[model samples]
Target chain A: MTIASEPADGYAVRSRILNFLKYGANSNPADPRVPFYRHPIFVRVAHWTNVIVLTVMLMSGLQIFNAHSALYWGYQSDFNHPLLSMVAMQNDDGSLKGVTQIGPWQFDTTGWLGASQVNGQWAVRGFPAWATIPGPQWLALGRLWHFFFAWLFVANGAIFASLAVYRGHFRRDLKPKVSDITGLPAEIAHHAKLQFPKGEAAKTYNGIQRLTYFTVIFIIGPLIVLTGLTMSPTLDSAFPFLPWLFGGRQSARTIHFLCAFSFVLFFIVHIVMVVLSGTWNNVRAMITGTYEIEQAGGRHG
Target chain B: MADGATRRGFLMRSFAGVATLALAGCDSISQQPWLDPLLRSAEALTMRVQRLFAGNHALAQEFTKADIAPMFRANGTLDPGTQEYRAHAQKNFADWRITVSGLVEHPLSLSMDQLRKLPARTQITRHDCVEGWSCIGEWTGAPLAHILALAQPKDEARYAVFYCADPMSDSNGDGINDSDFYYESLDMVEATHPQTLLAYKLNGQDLDIAHGAPVRVRAERQLGYKQPKYVKDIVLVDSLDKISGGRGGYWEDQGYNWWGGI
Candidate 1:
């Protein structure tokens, strides 16, 4: 059906679908004569590498954080109960089960009904049981993975940053021109109103995207890495400056948790934006490195 | 030159390629079981190299009494709920003798009084726990090296294992309980380090029961768990292979690292 004949909602949905199939909802395809992928092969490699590394780092980090049953604010005396606790155990039927602990200082194993008792023995109930794997558990292996992958994460990030600066990616894609920065008040208002002048979407990134992405790449990423290093006693000894830089080991740990929480927040917003804009188009560009664009009164495939 | 790639381009692409491979390996949540052996080997190699690097330099840091925290929380069993420990405590731990045996030239069971009389080193240092807690405390005790000298470790002895009076039983019966009184072993290098001591006093006062009174081994380089409390004997050994789970400590057997150096 033609765009003119479609219902308003239907038109929105179709546009979304088409957008998803073309550039991820927000990304603009390069001009016809320009290369299909805006990022060079090295940049793409570095970007995906970071994505994978960061995911593993976060998951393994959660596992390590789960090791301590209690988390404190100032000192051991100031320990606060975990926000959520899971009672981990194996069932008679050879399945795993978890009993969630909620509320203040109370452990509830009430939801553990489905699990069968093995050899007439009820499953062990505690925090570690929930997260720790039984018998030659890979805690050490997880640690090694976390440490080794951390190096790659940092190295890849460094390379990406260096290349960005060297290749003018920041200048071209991120940095606002003199007018854009000077007229930020109007630009911000325009964004808040969800209004984009014609041709503006393709040539310029919104202030919010620039600020968020820049913070993730420059501020949050480095903070996560630095705070993580401070948690290591070996590293702390070798680099005395770390503990001082982060207030102390515990403070560093707190910062690390904060940074990780911020990343999770960023991730949620990023996925929502993807879905809101056009999921398929974004996913396709990320995977295949090409996107079709819709020009004024015409379509360019 | 032949590929028409500049040196910078070649280096950049090579790094990116390796990073991609590493990232690919990290992508999957579940790794192949085969990765375990490789990781263990890498960890071992890293540990050995780290040990070598640290050998030439001083390891544990020394602090002042002012730096010592006002209170240090005791981890693990506060009191060994054993009749022997109770009886010993009733006698004021005066009769408690620490036996130095195994691969030693001179095996001796020395009384607490006798241990106190030996040459000692006092230092204020921080005890960091793996659970993300830390406390600084002043400890006065006989240097482990001095005690090892009195016991005269045999040339073959590689590790000094501290056996404690506390018997840790698995009351929960998960088939994991052995002796609850914690045991830890250290390589001879660390065992003989000048700073390594068998602490008898805390904060200028005799140690309290909850704080491993009578005697404890303070391997200050490691986290709090590595410091075995209520130490009653020292057993020198050639290897740790036959120890429980072959890792080196009560917690080490149950998932903690053997070399828990801070």
Candidate 2:
């Protein structure tokens, strides 16, 4: 239901103002007697499982990236041209110098990104020591960690998708209607002002959140998985069109890296929003499947 | 917001719980003895999914001559330094024989020249190493299926194990009389794959010593390690469990997966 459908009650309006002032935490509510059953039990389980799966996948993926540290736009790479590379050249004085080159643009990324000191010795590595699984330059073990969690990630993702479709989670929650777009500008402005919807408005996701979740789940999620599979040598032949579809294997690799960063960006924003909105309330809703909605009278239910 | 004390307590406790779980995953304790089976189960799922994608007869991507790398690296074993391998190299492998035995109607011992006379196939394909490097090379060799036909593998033959001459690990620093010899195996589908070959030629020339001369396996669907170099024998077996280290290949015994697809 649209936010306009609400009764236009004085308590709801006052509650919205109070929520805007306090940064969306359930406080100073006028109608605080209603509790919303928000998150489903299955969604809660899958969400937490994804926290672990994505952690392992991203870390190990960084480890895998360290092995080649170069991205290209074609099937083969010969060091002649690269779309991007994380590497450091050795100097005459035995010092390591790292650089990240994207096309003609080159940035000296010493002590980070491409090059770092591991155990007091300068080494050319992707990401950093803290960012890789096994925390070493072992590609073999990195692959093991990557493939292991990849299994879990894909399986969990399959479950999440099936449930989202079959159980109407998408329709009930994430799916956006035509009306969601009409309020986009106002929603963004309210977000920029740190003002949040309260009372019945807070019971369900806002338009921005609905759009974000839809994009992440349907668009980015599938693209990332498909691009990931495109990197496999066996799958290249089995599904020949995949490599060609993405332009080539290296192109798929570049897309995979960019998608990973997008995930990281989404994660950072998600956590920050969670904390700002109401850490305990959000976390509790995800855990116990119940959420307390605030109203204008400075009370919570 | 009025129940701030209780909410704060729950939040703090949940944060601590999640932190503990995450840290536990990062630590070595995650590799406890009890967890290996679970990990293997997950690995099995990965194998099944990969196999489902890679049908039995699908050929790996073949490249043109122009796409061939300038230097197709001979990794893992540059030279099988044993006296027997050296003797074979000195004589240009004139006396070298590859024995195809076990679970076959006829145990055939074919000389290097005899193998070259069989119906051969030439294809340029990418050699993807497990270490993440790749090189394209034009390989000319007898199709493994044609060679297997001469031996007539029995009904029970499910896997073909390729024996190599390389002594992978020798504590004495002397390659001779080493206990660790390199070997790799493939299931029936990969073994009989059209691209699967006992390659005797590389880049329009005779196989060099650095390469798996006399012959090395070319299982195009798998990683480079599965294509064992310095081949000396092919044994058809019902399972890989009875082999050395009971894994499938030397690298598999050393912690790589038995299935080397992708």
Best prediction by DockQ: 2
Residue A253 CA error for candidate 1 (Å)? Answer: 1.2
Give the alpha-carbon lDDT of every model. Answer: 0.67, 0.82
C-alpha positional error of residue B84 in candidate 1 after TM-score superposition, expressed in Å: 2.8
TM-score, every prediction: 0.72, 0.84
Per-residue lDDT of candidate 2, residues A140-222 (tens digit):
66677788788788889889989988888888778997888998999999887767677778777899999998888778888
Q: Per-residue lDDT of A191-250 in model 1, one digit per residue for the tens?
A: 555443323254445666667778888899999988876665545445667767877666
Clashes of each: 7, 8
Q: Between which residue pairs do clashes occur in model 2?
A: A28-A298, A29-A295, A29-A296, A29-A297, A29-A298, A30-A295, A30-A296, A30-A297
lDDT of 1 by residue, B137-214 (tens): 889999988888988999999999998876678667765444555788988887887778999999999989888987
Interface RMSD of each: 4.8, 2.0
**Candidate that scores best on TM-score:** 2
Q: Supply the DockQ value of model 2.
A: 0.44
- Give the lDDT of residue A300 in candidate 2: 44
Candidate 1 CAPRI category? incorrect
Instruction: Supply DockQ values for each candidate.
Output: 0.19, 0.44
